[model samples]
Target: MDGAGSGVWNDGSVHVDDQVGQGVSADLAAFLRNADDDRPVKIVSSVCGECGGRVFVVLVDDVEGGAERVCTGCGGRAFIADSAEFWGEADPGEAGCPCGGGEFETAVTFSLAADGPVRWVTVGLRCEQDGLCGIYVDWKIDYGPTDHLLALA
Candidate 1:
């Protein structure tokens, strides 16, 4: 949280505490550290209905529309009707990792700005077993995760 929403470190990662993606993701984590208690992030560990799979979800926002997810098992796709519900975990534990094998490795750096006007955030998870890989879309209908982040300022 040294330089939230600011510069980059020697390693090339953002200066913000990467608490959500580990200890090294974005300034969102630094903001989350000071987030309001009333508006806590709503996180869920959903079991894939098609394959009975547990996942560590990374959200992806579709600027044109809603949220989407690709199943790790059946390759089935699921969409969250609300695009704002999904938010990154400040602690960003390993439990959300879709890959159950050998510790989930980063398939990609899920950024909060990828959604453009929609401002959707997406994180990637890769599983060594069956190569289970996918993202979790923040589909919360009640509130905007991005808005909440902005409010933190």
Candidate 2:
């Protein structure tokens, strides 16, 4: 495990390495703040740069509040806004029983701030009560998936 409070941002958003989502989401904030070593969780992000390169953040835990993602590859940048949306879900096949016989899922949506060619990314954290899980974060260049790009910043 990375460190208890070390994984969460002071502004409430969870921080992963250059690739993880800070546990700022609503449902996972509390869980993230109080999570232990065995129960590890982090936010991820998908970013598309202006130069046509993709920075697929497998885990984003190093970013602090107000900081954006800068395309190390193309000079593209992403800034973390004052706030982001965080949602979670508990389903039967997701959060399994403690007996290691069932499976359960928990998801978290990390909404990044909009800027330049990269608008925002929604990342999900899925897991089983038994601690089995997966993570996904896809970047949306515009507000709408089909929306147009306004600038090249």
TM-scores of all models?
A: 0.31, 0.25
Write down the lDDT of every candidate, Cα atoms only.
Answer: 0.33, 0.31
> Candidate 2: which stretches are off by over 4 Å?
1-103, 114-118, 144-153
Question: lDDT by residue for model 2 over 1-153, one digit each (tens)?
Answer: 332222444443333321233222344334433342222233332243466433312223323212233343565544322112211221112222335523222223333332222244333332333443333233433344422222111
45-69 per-residue lDDT for model 1 (tens digits): 2334578554423334433333344
TM-score of model 2 vs. true structure? 0.25
lDDT of 1 at 107: 23
Model 1 stretches astray by more than 4 angstroms: 1-38, 55-59, 62-65, 83-153
TM-score computed on alpha carbons, candidate 1: 0.31
